[model samples]
Target: MDVNRRNEMKKVIVSVKLRDILIGILIFNICIVIFSLIVVGVNKGNRQLKYGNTENKQIEHNNSKVDLDLKKEKDTILNKKIDSCINLYLTREKRIVKLDLEQYVLGVVSAEMPANFNIEALKAQAVAARTYAVCHTKHLVGGGCSLNANADICDSVHCQAYISQEKRMKTWPKKERAELYNKVKEAVESTRGQVLSYDGELVMNPYYFATSSGKTENSEEVFKESKPYLKSVESPGEEVAPKYKTQFKFSNANFTTVMNSQFKGLNLNSNIIKDKINILERSQGGSIKQIKIGNITTTGKMIRKLFGLPSANFTISFESTNIVFNCKGYGHGVGMSQWGAGVMAREGKKYDEILRHYYSGIEIKTLNYK
Candidate 1:
């Protein structure tokens, strides 16, 4: 009778174990189903875009059906990468040194300023960007440029970060492949997110300094490497270039003439605007003559219109450079030049050449996702 009791107890335990196993399988299936449904719903939704301001939520567009199919393919094959993107970014010393592929792409892509940009350029930028994303999945654990994860300033300012612009514009300059790749890769690898606020909102990219006349205004002003004040460092070497005639030297008459009309294109009093320009001189080291409301402060020469910011603040300093006013590059003279890159790309050069022109001596590597 005891032996019978033992056998019966064993049978009961086996049944309970089987029941637990079956329950576990059911729960797993349910989770999978729910997860799959959520994914489908999300895929169906359009990717919303917000520009300089978000009060007005503007959706750039929804991708094509073909694009969606590709996304699906990528989603299936690289779900691991996508999941990694959703995970919390890792940081060290308050810098976002670590990011998944998606976050990396987000950081770099968001930094681009491609307004009515080129398809080929977009593809090229994406291809180069993706290569870095895949390569530096885990190893890109540190940032070098303007990035403070907690500050929301990561990759925003001093860093060559992504800004919203047209993809088609990238093709205009025509840069090489290697150079383009390097530039994009450098930005992705070095930038970290900051947590600062600008205009009551977060400052996405915050570090900005001008390199007027090719010297960081501060660097040249502080270090008088040249005999004359007007001289500037031309090539990337220690020696200073010869000083040239400055536009500031307007035969005293022309100075007064341009000064009167320099702020001419716009409707602003030269006298009132002159006051603002004077402030930038003591404040910015660059001598100023023309000042306009709503001028993009970064790239002083380019009217805010080209950047799509019709109303911007910009102060143009008429510094002495014997060279013609017709310019080669764009922007605040502090960071990367897409125009320069485009020129190189158009010339059938590599991305590396483009990167070297903009940034100096930055290493490229791939980080593991694990």
Candidate 2:
């Protein structure tokens, strides 16, 4: 009976221990499952944050590209506006030619002035040419060249000498053509869209001429009209011009015939004509303002034309073989003298200084074409 009791006790104790061990294993497995679930949830949240950041960066890059495109579009629109305002010009060939304003000025400069002149002198010429063009457009009131009613100005010096690029290329030597063209083009571009004004008004007629004898003439003296800007001013250093001093000799018969033909009322006695030709008055520029031939009193301009004299600044003398006219200067001796400007530029005078010296009380301003 004792042996039976002991065996029953041993079985009960073993069964209890086995149940505790099973319970411990079940608890450990449950804890491992809960930890695994928590770790997986945390990993999923980190992946979503990384994805969101990558999308935000892509959106910022896309926005930057859109901004750059908008800027480029704006720049193109601005360029068109500038072109529309400046690319309309009329040509003498009865044609409406489209040319950039600066380019037109370059052609005019190349034609109207020597290419070898100083850069500052060329710049001054460009500004003057531009102002002249703008002024003509305003004064024309939509009118055009007298010869061509549809043209703004002729390609001749009668208006402003303008040579086309094709003509320039044909006329200039092949090696020198591009260099000469660039020189003039640079002058125009450097002073692009610049014009001259006086008392807040655009200068309509800025006259310029070749070499002056010693001084520029007053507008009243030359044109019979006073212009405040065009005043008598001493122009030095023009004596260096090649034709600054020239002489014209005419045979007695030729001189008499020319004089009689021009003035029908006059009968010239060749023997006494030398004594009769006398300068009565001289302008401030030392040009012959008035002269007396026999009993006819006329302006020096008439004598210059009748005798084919280069300028009105001359002294008549009788040579053993012919009547000689010793002349000075080449043109009307009015406004800005080309040779004078060259000299001034060589002396380190800027374009503005040169212009102010010639055109008194003037202002250099930007083109205000509406």
Candidate 3:
């Protein structure tokens, strides 16, 4: 072959090989991009399948539907009215401070009942606390705190137990403080301005306590005052309460000494303590109404107060070395039982229904004070 022609053929071959190499490289780059797109699409699908629908369904099942916009608007108007009208006297601080009524209700509900209780139970407590506050407020009823005449209501449990936001935050577990507080806030705000009333008047005493011995007492039996709304009623399903049943053991000497101290001239002897102690009368609700000890006849309420018993619904038994007082329920057993309310809530009862059940013939009324 001639030298020039051979050189031209070699250059053409080299150009063709370079073109083939460039086409192969382009195909490889296209494949890489396609694989990356497929990988990203798969990951996105997996994430949606794993998290999105499941989380939404869980939320829907766990929480009742709430209209956040409506709640916020109502809260704003309520807050303004309460800020102008309500004030509380803190016994510990010994000062009267003005606060929103709903805020005070939140504190009382949180302090008075377990925050972990069902939402309905908390709502019942919120309404009862609000009614108590309204009935006692000097601004509304001219009834001021008995302890301090300068204030509408006192913070102590004598009125209602209250804990400030700062103290509540400190008291609840760090991991759960915010969530628990939100639960309580929801309960208080959801039932805002609702109170218990009988015959167009705020119920004078919407009393409540920790637990009941299967039934609540008539007001006449416990408080010596007859309240039509506070009549005895069967309160069931409270066996799960922590204080449902309790025992306090007292040595014979200790029991005798305490009894003598409370009722003078009794001269109760340790050996004859069991013989001298006699239960004379019991209320319809199963709490001791009157008892005879030695030569003295005393009311069960007085004995309960003197010995620091949980309730008057107690049975006395003589042991070998100690006198055992087996008590059923906590508190006076005269009003709504908190544990009973919780059980009702879990059984799907609404807050208003629970309140009506406890306070006979009472109406749940919305406050119109502005």
The best candidate in terms of TM-score:
3
Candidate 2 per-residue lDDT over residues 1-75, each given as its tens digit: 699999999999999999999999999999999998888689677654455577986788899998676445433
RMSD of each candidate? 24.1, 29.4, 24.6
Candidate 2 runs further than 4 Å off: 1-98, 138-144
- What would the TM-scores of all predictions be? 0.30, 0.72, 0.76
* Residue 313 lDDT in candidate 2: 89
Residue-wise C-alpha lDDT for candidate 1, range 1-370, written one tens digit per residue: 6999999999999999999999999999999999988876775574332334333433222345555654454333332322234212233334344444445554454456342222233333443444433322222222223233333223443333543224323553565534544444444344322112212221112222212333322223323232121222222221121221122222323333443454444443433443333223221333221333423122333333333221122323443421112221123333233433343455565655434343333222222243
Candidate 3 residue runs with Cα over 4 Å from true position: 1-84
Q: Using alpha carbons, what is the TM-score of model 1?
A: 0.30
Residue 203 shift from truth in candidate 3, angstroms: 0.8
Better of 2 and 3 by TM-score: 3
Error of 3 at 56 (Å): 72
Which scores better on lDDT, 2 or 3? 3
Residue 171 lDDT in model 3?
88
